[model samples]
Each structure stands twice: as C-alpha cells, then as structure tokens.
Target: MTRVPFTASCSTSIHKCCLVNTINIGTTSLAAFPNSLALPFVPHTKATSVRRISVVAMSDLSKSTVLVTGAGGRTGQIVYKKLKERSDQFNARGLVRTQESKEKINGDDSVYIGDIRNTETLASPIQGIDALIILTSGVPKMKPGFDPAKGGRPEFYFEDGANPEQVDWIGQKNQIDAAKAAGVKQIVVVGSMGGTNLDHPLNSLGNGNILVWKRKAEQYLADSGIPYTIIRAGGLQDKEGGIRELLVGKDDELLQTETRTIARADVAEVCLQALKFEEAKFKAFDLASKPEGTGEPTKDFKALFSQITTTF
Candidate 1:
C-alpha cells in the first residue's frame, strides 16, 4: 500500500488560512480539519470538500451595542453587568426609568434614563443599538393595611397609568417599533410563564391581566418580522445562578412541575445566551430550572436553546 497526499485549502476573511488535509486509508478518504469549521465530519469523495467547509466562523468577534431596557431591575441589572464585563464582545448600555434607578447601578455613563412606557424617551437609548433586551414589566404593589401576620392574602394594584396594558403591551410594542426602525438585529424579551391562561393567578393580581397583556406583546414581537427570542420564565427566584439544570417547555407545561422556578441570574444569563446563538432566534418558550443538586448545572447554552422549537 502506498500513502497519498493532497492539499486542500479553505478561503475566508474570518481566518488567515484554513487548510483541510485528506488522508486515504484504503478505498475510504477521510477529511481532517479544524473543529472550528462549521461542517460536520464526513468521509469525503474528493478534496473539493474543502471548499464546502470554507464558511465563516459561527462566533462573531465584532462588538454589538446592546441596550437593556429596565436595566435597573433585578435580572436586567445582571444582564447589563455581564455584558459590560464582556467588553470585548459587547458595548453594554442600560436604560432605566428614573435617575434614582440610574444611581443604583453606580450612575454609570453607559446607563440611560428613559421611560419604556413612552416611545419618545426611548429614542436616545434605542439609537444605533445592534440588539435590545426587553426586561421591562408592570409592577404590582400590595394594597395598604395588610400584614403577613394576619394570614390573609393581600390585594394588589398597579399604580395609575402603569397597568399591564400600558406597561406590558403598549410599552413593549413601542420598544419593538423603535428597535425595528433603528435596524436592530435582535430582540430578547423576558416575560412570565403563566401567559397561556387568562385566569392564571398572575393575571388576577391588581386586576392587571398582566399575563394576558404580556402574551399580547409577545405575539406583537413575533409578528414584527424582526429576529426575536422570547423567554417566559417561571417564578423568578433570587437564588444563585449556574447551579441548577435549566428546563424549557411550551404553553406553561412546566408550571405543573415542582421545578417551576429559576434564578434571576440564570434568566439574565439565558437572555445574553439568546443573542449568541442562531437557534435561539425567532423562538419563544417557558423557562424553569430543577432544584439545585438534582442534576448537573446547565453550561452549554447552545444545546439548551437548540431544544426549543417554538415560535411565539
């Protein structure tokens, strides 16, 4: 038997040089190349397969300016901070409703004060952003004169002009419109998991119909024709992230399970991960996590997002 050698080259601006080396073991020719190549390993009939693998790398090194609406909120702050930490890949910007909220994040220059409910205020923050993460939601405040010691459920209500319809539906619609007009590439929306049921307990909170209105915005975003990722997270907890097995489902199915809550930090991480992967695009699903120590913590976000097939 005689050994045969052939030169195979891949041309791309992403890499200085991409070389594919083919070896013949008997009648079969196997191609060996860098794992960075986007193609799967397969037996090649000829050296021309090298051209097939000449595609650009999946990871984009260019920095994207990402704006986090509601950046003062628990999960939003985490996402904003994570992006700021990854300065090489992202130009992180935070949008808060008030100056006090801005001060909470150390009054960073990157933080922008804006009212998500008002489209006019969002213009400056939405300008020239490559992506937008919508973390804004209506807040429900408990009515006065109630105590936990009383052992009775406290009533809830949204402040004047801040109901679910205004904040969840209209505010989000405005953001979508503004982002679309700005030529934003991607949008990641974090919402609650109970949107499937109109009578879900959350909707009854403050007579706000929160989930109902949120579902409306989710659909609007889906129809906007812009690439989007909608994450309806279940029962957000303040626990540590990256310590539990994250799960995804559709139509609030995960709400029935005991593991129906996820950490705010994990939700923040998922929001950022949605921006990195193509599979996470145009997808919407319920997000939850198993109890810590029950299984291995979720690390491969690409695999986790690949499990979702739903659109809105």
Candidate 2:
C-alpha cells in the first residue's frame, strides 16, 4: 500500500462516468467508515455498488446572534453556556427578568434584562437576534414531595407574572411576535409533553392545564410561517447529561402513562442542535432520554432530528 498527499486544490465528477474508488479525505480516518460497508476505494463493477459523496469546503465561520429566554433558569443557563462555548458558530445573549437573574449569568455583559410577559419589554432584548431559543416556563410553587390534596402546594402561578396562561401561552406569543418583528429567521421553543391529552396529570396542578396552553402556543408558532423547531421535553430533572442516549419523536409518539424524564443539560444540548441544523427546522417533536449505558450516546443530532415528523 502507498500514501499520496492531497493538495488544497482538486476537481472531479465533471461527467456522468465518474469513478469513486480509494477516495482520501483530509482529517478522516478508517474508523469513520462502517465495518460492513463497501469501501468507495474498493473495486466495483457497477455504478449501483458505489455511493457518491460530495466534499465541499466549509468556509463560513460567521456566527448567528442568538438570544435565550429564561436564561437564568436551569436548562436555559446550560443552553447559554453551550452556545458561548461554540463562539465560532453562535453569539449568545441571555435575556433575564430582573437584575438578580442577570447577575446569575456569570457576570456576562451579554445578559439583557427583559420580561417576556410584557411585549414592550421584549423588543430591545430581541432587537437584532438572528435566532431565539426559548426555555421559559411558569414556575409551580411546589416541592417534589408537596401534594395539593394534602393541604399543601399553593401559589402555582407564583407572583403577578409567572402564571401558565400568561407565560407558557402569552409570553411565548409575545416572543414569537417580537422575533417576527425583528426579522429573525428561526425560533426554537422548549416545552413539555402531555400537551395533547386533557387528562394528563400535569394539568391537574394549579388547574393550570399548562400542557394545553403550551399546545396552543405551539400551534401559533407553527402557523407563524417562520423556520421553527419545537422540542417538547419530558420531566426536567436536574442531573448530569451527555451520558444517556437521547430519544425523540413527533405528535407525542413517545408518550405513555409512565412518567418519562430527561436531564436539563441534555435538553440544553438539543436546543442548540435544533437552532443550528436545517434538519430540525419546521418540526416539532417530543424528547426524552433512554438510560445510562456504556455505549456512546448518539451525537448525530441532525440524523436524530430527521427521523422525527413535523408538527403541521
């Protein structure tokens, strides 16, 4: 066997009869290929036996200016950090409600104070954003052990602002309207499951019917005609992510009676992926985690997104 150096300039596939054998790509290794697949370099008698691959140079280092709603919250904070880590691809800004919330963002200058419930306050926050990643949700004032029927768990709506009908539905609508007004190209919203069935237990809390209002907002988003992706996640648990495999589906296809849950970090990772990939655009899907395992978790987010259906 012999090795040949590939130059910065090369050309091929100029005609119908193109030969695809023993191809060499830069920074690529044998481990990149599947074990059972036929090597493109292998001798092939017919065209059907070989698949064509286009190698285009990726020179676009330009980044999108992204604004994250609920940036002070659990998943929103993670999403903000992940976007900032990939600064070459994304310029991240955190939109928080109060000065205290703004201080939580690592003392970053990108933190902008704004409340989503008020349309007037949202314009400056989304003035020049290219994409909006919304992780905001109304906080239910109840601990894990708290039960409403047992003389506990009150103030599900919290203060004057944090109600489900206002935040989950109207707050989202305000964001959508602001995004459209700003000429933003894409909107990625993080919501939860059980938005379909009226009997789902999540609705019983505060009689808020949070999922129902969430669905209404989702429909409003879809009909807005903007390039959008809605990721309806399961129970949001505060745990370490990147270790479990991500599972996704459309129209609540993955929903069941048993409560499914996922880590905030994992959801944060998916929110970034949804913002970046065209495959995730114009789609709404449910997201959950499989479990802890020794095998590697799925990293091909575009492929994972493509398998799901759209939210028409």
TM-score of each: 0.80, 0.75
Question: lDDT by residue for model 1 over 1-312, one digit each (tens)?
Answer: 233343365455433323334434434565544435543434545532334323323333356789999999989889988999888788899999889999988758889998878789989999978899999999999999998997989999999999999999999999999999998999999999988788899989999999999999999999999999999999999988999999999999998989899999999999999999999999999999999899899999999999998997
Q: Write the per-residue lDDT of candidate 2 for residues 1-312, one digit (tens) a residue.
A: 234333333233221122222333443422222222343454334422333353321222246789999999988989989988988788789898889977877837788888888899888879878899988888776535556689944544344667789999999999999999999999999998777789987788777888888888989999999999998998889999888878886666677724367889999999888876889999888888886773468798989888877664
Best by lDDT: 1
Q: Give the worst 10-residue stretch by lDDT in candidate 1.
A: 52-61
Off by over 4 Å in 1: 1-61
